[model samples]
Target: MPAGQWSSAQGASTSTSDLSGRYGNGRPRGQALIVILAVLAGVSGVAWLIWVTGFHGRPLAQSGLTAYEIVDDHRATATLTVTRRNSGVVANCLLRAYAEDHTTVGELNFTLDGSDPKRVDLTKSVRTEREATSVELVGCTADGQPRPR
Candidate 1:
């Protein structure tokens, strides 16, 4: 095109200016992309926190252990007794007692037939009465099968 013909055509486009345009110190494309990614990351983090922590705090257990008698702060020894159920030959019956902070203070190991009511004594293993705080009895097979909870 000739220069004079191009000058005449440009006059018509001069009136079609963008109204909302202003001089701006624009943010770089990298910075804008980083801000967009940060926003998305924050939203996803909140969603994951909500999904992991449900209505209840504890995990879903198939069967909770039946807590029998909770003996705490007993003199010289703490003891927890549960009704002994008749299983096969109970090779090992252990009454493991702990302190208030779940520290193993004493353990009384004994062999008892599941058919009869037996008492496991922690007094023999417990040297100090002050250390005995919380007690729990766990019976298990010698082969590692956890006794019926």
Candidate 2:
């Protein structure tokens, strides 16, 4: 209760010390909170990356239909370009033939033995029950769904 006085009271002792002395540099709380949040964010990002690339497996190939020739109503041939990497791992691609209305008329399952790095251009014959207009590559994967030993 006095301007210049000494007391053993609890609140009096806290007031006597300077604010910086009491809570070092006025940044202890904020600095600690920032550090904790940064660590958590880093850990969460690494976990998500592992889950995506490890469990889901990385893509090893991509395919495109370069050209198609309509041989007849029941059969056609298409030129396919496949770019594959990760040598020695088998890759598979799914190709589909579609009509003008985007209806799938036929499908082909193509496999690459993965002997070497691939920039392969090959012709494949596709068969449809009815006439089809265009050929397209649907998807490609390297995961062979290996059988458990």
Candidate 3:
């Protein structure tokens, strides 16, 4: 019945010491479990961050469209500059030529031998179904890896 006191369901007065003794070591129940779970979550989050940043951050190979020329109505030339992380692994690249309407008029699948330099500029002649206005390097992959999205 005191202003600063609490009563149990049985109308019995309870004090802070009574609650502390009811729990272990004067700490709330499940506090240790919550702390353990939080520590585990923190550890796993760090591990995931490391895996993402260290392993999957950089691509194996990269390509850039250097120059393109419309040789004729059915022919075009594309120059691609490619770079790879591992020079000992072979890399495959895709080049596409598009018409004025942005439709693919030709496509070329090329391979860079492992013996070649890590960074190389390649000129390829593409035979197209019609006149192509622009060319693009689609992507590149190494060691039979999946093409980059």
Question: Which of the two candidates, 1 or 3, achieves a greater TM-score against the reference?
Answer: 3
Window of ten residues with lowest summed lDDT in model 3 = 140-149
RMSD in Å for all candidates: 12.3, 7.5, 5.1
Off by over 4 Å in 1: 1-24, 55-58, 62-96, 99-103, 106-133, 136-149
Tens digits of per-residue lDDT for model 2, 1-149? 68777667836545535876767675578898999999999999999999978754634676677888878897778887777655676767777788878899988887889685667788988898799898877766766533210
TM-score of each: 0.33, 0.62, 0.76
Error of 2 at 149 (Å): 28
Residues 34-137, candidate 3, lDDT per residue (tens digit)? 99999999999999999978765666788888889999999999888888887886888898899999999999998888898988988999999999999888
Tens-digit per-residue lDDT, 28-144, candidate 1: 799999999999999999998887676223221111213323334443343433333233345454556666777776766655455644333223233424456655556433333
Evaluate residue 141 in candidate 2 and report its C-alpha lDDT on the 0 to 100 scale. 72
Residue pairs clashing in model 1 are: none
**In model 2, which runs have C-alpha deviations exceeding 4 angstroms?**
1-25, 28-31, 39-58, 144-149
Clashes of 1: 0
Arrange candidates by TM-score, descending. 3, 2, 1
Number of backbone collisions per candidate: 0, 0, 0
Error of 3 at 115 (Å): 1.1
